[model samples]
Target: MLPRLNLRTSFQLAYRARFGWLATGSLVALLSTALLSAQFSGRQPATVALDTGLSVLRLLLSLVLVLMTQELLSREFDRRYFLNTLSYPHPRHSLLLGRFAAVAILTLGLLLLLAVALALLAWLIGQGYAQATPVALGSQYLVTIAFIGVDLLLLTAVASLLAVVASTPSFVLLGTFGFMLVARSFGAIVELLTRNTAVVTDAENYRSGIGLLGYLLPDLGALDVRMIALYGRMELLPADWPWLLLSCLVYTVGLLAMAVWALQRKHFA
Candidate 1:
């Protein structure tokens, strides 16, 4: 049992890869902004524009997390770089946490860059078409961005946790993507199964199954504040903010704990 851990070394290893990933994120942001500028809508161009830009940024951020997780964990371990790092005095948990922190920092930084770019584009578009459009951005938009950051952090932890159990980079990437899809949709699936009795088959059983999944998966739906931001519904934000943050923390910690457990048991030989 290793008692001492070197977080700095692990973080150094993780941070070294940030430049490439950040460039990829920036390119995606640029393309998303360009698409927003080119969109044509007969009604509510502002809403459409905001939605399209956000959707693109969200997808791009997701991709960044997936790729980042693969690069930082799966590939490094596959190539024995991570094992070499572990050869140092660092405990498995410390290495996992340090790498997680590095990835979280990178994701948060990219989120900030993307948010600023989106805001700048929104502002410019509003100014360019103020009279012809209803583009209104406020601090509330920042609130949405903050929640999106939380969502990405949660995803980073999820991907990190999955990578520990996954054998190959491809498996980690695909598994992470699939888990993201399910976690993001878990709430909606539950609602649909419970509310739409006509479409749902064996409603009770389906609900039970989904409920079990919900218990196991993080409720990402709670972090979705885009609609509130889009409609400027600041009043509705308060009720969920505290709970959402708490849930995000709980889920992130849980995932990291699992990753640490997996790493402790993982044999480099």
Candidate 2:
């Protein structure tokens, strides 16, 4: 029988499979340090070292989660292993759905673990820790996770689509990275453009509009919410949540549609 991946099963498999390997090793290592430091008393160590350590860990793992999603399609396509997936009785759409769902769940679990670890580390920081209301903390972390998810989903779409066209994982990774690195610099370009335009037009008027245009070129940096999450400024706006959710859904599904079309046309040698 084909796997019925609604919400629950998809999430469960994610945690059991990928999430554990990616997050657990790192978490455990950090936790071990925290435990060993229990007796040594110095606020600076936990505040600077522990807090920043866990934060960086979470960020890296989040990136890994996204990269892994891209590779899911890349590897199978590279090795001519799509046959195994096809043999299962599940359609390609269902398989893609399962892969996305599994990755989402893994990402989510890592988010939860990140929250708990950060929360504990913050509590231990004494004066360095800012007091946050429950709602504020929730909003901050939720946005962080959402930001990561949106970025990864977009990248996954690009990766899958690239594989469909390029037909090699190494080629796909290099091309995608090149395209993405160029796109990332657009924020600074937008800033420079804003400054120059202000002198010419007497306004920063369309600066944000230009920035919005950055969305088309793959704005993965936007998904990183650490600065906001830690600083307590950019909480998930009411509109932000729905926009990201909608964007991820549209991008992923649209790319997969393109992938399916490519696969149908592809002549496997």
Candidate 3:
């Protein structure tokens, strides 16, 4: 009950705090980018719109997540706001969980809004002319957006964990961004090293190093199903959706647990 109340209060506060400008700016950016891409794409307007819109969505949501996490969690601790928060008649973990929930909800709301608008824009752009390969604005597109949501949520977990563990507020942003960059690029790096082994010296050692790093980080690139959305390439999907979702769930839960543990022992002074 206490956690629930905290979650509600935190969510309301977060929404009232900065969500207005964030939502406005995100929508404007998404619409402008999609419109411009469609206008210049010539024949494949819908495909180009989806591609650009998705990229913009990913980038904007990532920035919002980092900023919100820093503001709600790290900055609160930095400014000693947590002192008053900790004085509440609730466990420390509840506060952390509540704030994290608020950020997650806000991030997801933004993602949904932008995704819907992008879909509508793509559909409108494609109405004039039909390309050879029409964009999949149906289930495939929704699935792609859903995977992007999962990826962002995973990063939210990472940010939450860093918020509790990092000594300084800036580290939260730096650490989360670092994690995101590495996780997103890990697959590409591995693939490059694999396909062009002969082009580089000590390719085997590089692969071994990257393979070990893969164990420590999630392969976020695998979550990008934009190609499937853009080309309606169902074959690009993973064989087992359940397993993929399970893996992401397990990772998210683990990250949240670590965050809870860290907050429980965090010194608020």
Q: In model 2, which regions exceed 4 Å deviation?
A: 5-19, 28-59, 127-136, 179-185, 196-215, 225-228, 234-249
| Residue-by-residue lDDT tens digits, candidate 3, 187-232 | 8888988899986789989888888877888778888879889999
Best candidate, lDDT-wise? 3
Clashing pairs in 3: none
CA lDDT, every model vs. true structure: 0.74, 0.58, 0.87
Q: Rank the candidates by lDDT, best first.
A: 3, 1, 2
Model 1, position 209, has a per-residue lDDT of 82
Give the poorly placed runs of model 1, Cα more than 4 Å off. 1-18, 21-38, 131-136, 193-195, 201-205
TM-score per model over all chains: 0.85, 0.64, 0.94
Candidate 3 ranges with C-alpha deviation above 4 Å? none
Give the winner by TM-score: 1 or 3.
3
Tens digits of per-residue lDDT, candidate 2, 175-194, equal: 65665565546666676776
Displacement of the residue 263 alpha carbon in candidate 2, Å: 2.6
Residue 84 accuracy (lDDT) in model 2:
64
lDDT of 1 at 53: 76
List clash counts for every candidate, in order. 0, 0, 0
